[model samples]
Target: MVFVESELGLHSELESVNAVKILIAGGFGVGKTTLVTTISEIAPLRTEEQLSALSASVDDLTGVESKTTTTVALDFGRITLSSELVLYLFGTPGQDRFWFMWKELSVGALGAVVLIDTRRLEECFSAVDYFESRHIPFIIGVNCFDGADVYDEDEIRAALDLSEQVEIRYCDVRDRESAKQILISLMEYLVAGANSGV
Candidate 1:
């Protein structure tokens, strides 16, 4: 448990604990907000706005193209897995135009989850590239959209040119259990990597 000495005799855990920051990053309408809300202990914070005419030219309108609201800034939420394991989840804005915020969003992050839309797999390239460039450990989750072609893990790995070491899998963002599984997979991957000093 996290503990801190306080003059104000009312002691509270987390008074001196450092939380691990984890980034949930992806392209437009990739279910980042849903995943954060599903697992966070607190209500997730999001900067969402209705789609304007100008957004059509920019945001992808293919699969979730009908999605009216989009997250503009970052989404923040907290989840405490154990007495000493608090996690701060930061959901990044997905539009490629907001690329400038990525570096700042990534600062001091333990790792990231790169969500991908199967219909627009190429859109995830930038997110993958960014993490790889910075050498931040991350897992790629293919957000399975209705009517989209289903690809096996091997096919996805080959198609994304993912190195053998990178973790890749499929997920359905709307399902809370599915989302939780994805996060658990990422946590395991990160813990294993840390133990191996990777």
Candidate 2:
């Protein structure tokens, strides 16, 4: 929890606020940037560059061939979840070459939202492994792309090799309400774990 100096003089009435760090991580073209932009209160900062022809061989574009730009570094955004809490979101670049930045971005993060595209579930394997090995709590947000086949939560969990404790939810990252729910779900999970001493 964190306390801030308020001009309204409402500190005495309201409790201290919490500022949490959260990571939005997933594979390339998985809508990490879209999710951040959708829910941020302020204009989000994005470090994206036009896809270069020279790097075509290095970056795979099987499903997302229409993508013109790729995040080179990271995306930063913030949202006030409530009067008592605010969330800082950091979206990691999805390319393998930029994975070195994940270690830095992930530091001090409360938890993560692993966005997934059903068309390329295999692309998220590294992210899932990274979070699991570090013991960081995370929930899977399956971005339902148009025409993409939908899978039940249990099936996705088995495919991702996740334990029963990890939660999986369907989401449409482009919708602000849906994006907000993902963050709320993560916070709820974190609070539950803290209460359970897990």
Candidate 3:
């Protein structure tokens, strides 16, 4: 006998299948991987390599002087927002050499979070430009690192030369709640853009 939609339990499953792909992006030594690990329901997949003297010239360790590992390709994670909504997080590698992977990683992404560290604000320029030039919806998540100087949203936006329409959020990527809020802000931004047909 053939099962009906309700009888087969596929009705709710099919109707509640809203899955969104979002990129957690930023500059070198930013908290892209940490953000994914903090909020992902499953164990986050990190394509990180240990920092070596061999590549010291290529990778800049400015603000994050003690960063031991670097994301070589991408970091992957997933979080279920609700029965009707799920988010797949793709964290991009920050170094210049690994940037080629971004094209692949961003293929199906609907939006992105550009995580930035205040100490090295210039590092995020490439990421900001990448997303902006592509017209991709993104939010700037300023990662509040311990001992880092604090800047208001206006200052950062001015420094980044971002349009006022862009959203900015402050967060401690290591904190689950803070990271989740950043994702929430992105979702809200994306939803607003969609509603406006932007």
Candidate 4:
């Protein structure tokens, strides 16, 4: 529990906390839903639908051949980062057809994490641009995948056109601990930005 010192110099537990909204965005098949499910305290709310043959013309599945389903709207989850802070995660649908929902989902968001799939690097450019255009503070999380080509931090940073100040962490969204750490890093970055008034 988080405690605050009252004017009387007595310590009291905090009962109320404002929940921050965070968007998990990325290109198609970048594991945004998986990341939310791995770290969410409650069962995640998924808006997924099976991919049919008609989807081939609209959705690009260049690197993610095995992906059978796609997030049609959004994936919702909740996580308690600290006793004083709770986060509401909204995972945006990755397809361009659903790009309309990104703006709606991003309303009042504190920041975002653009999950990256190294194999489909170009696919994430739209997500990165959306957050950048809105002036929202965000970080890149390299969602490491098995059998994917390895890319260094410098390479990713350059490829994404991110400044040196933007933090990047390697993680596998399927692993709860690894994904949680990336969230922790994002919270830390947000705190530091708040402290520095960035």
Quick one: best lDDT, which candidate? 2
Candidate 2, residue 157: how far the Cα is off, in Å: 0.8
**Residue-by-residue lDDT tens digits, candidate 4, 1-198:** 222322222245434556799999999999999999998888899999999999987888888988999999999998876666778899999989999998899989999999999998998899989988998989999999999999999999999998887899999999988888888889889989999999
How do all models score by TM-score? 0.89, 0.92, 0.92, 0.91
TM-score of 1: 0.89
lDDT of 3 by residue, 73-182 (tens): 89999887766677899999998888899999989899999999999998899999999988889999999999999999999999999999899999999998898889
Cα-lDDT of candidate 1: 0.83
TM-score of 4: 0.91
Off by over 4 Å in 2: 1-15
lDDT of 1 by residue, 139-174 (tens): 998888888899888888888899988898688878
User: How many residue pairs clash in each candidate at the backbone level?
Assistant: 0, 0, 0, 0
Residue pairs with clashing backbones, model 4: none
In candidate 2, which residue pairs get closer than 3 Å at backbone N, Cα or C atoms, i.e. clash?
Answer: none
Clashing pairs in 3: none
lDDT of 3 at 140: 98
Q: After superposition, how far is residue 80 of candidate 3 from its true place, in Å?
A: 0.6
Instruction: Report the error of model 2 at residue 75, Å.
Output: 0.4
Q: Candidate 2's residue-wise lDDT over 50-102, tens digit each?
A: 99997788889999999999999999998876666778899999989999999
Stretches off by above 4 angstroms in model 4 are: 1-15
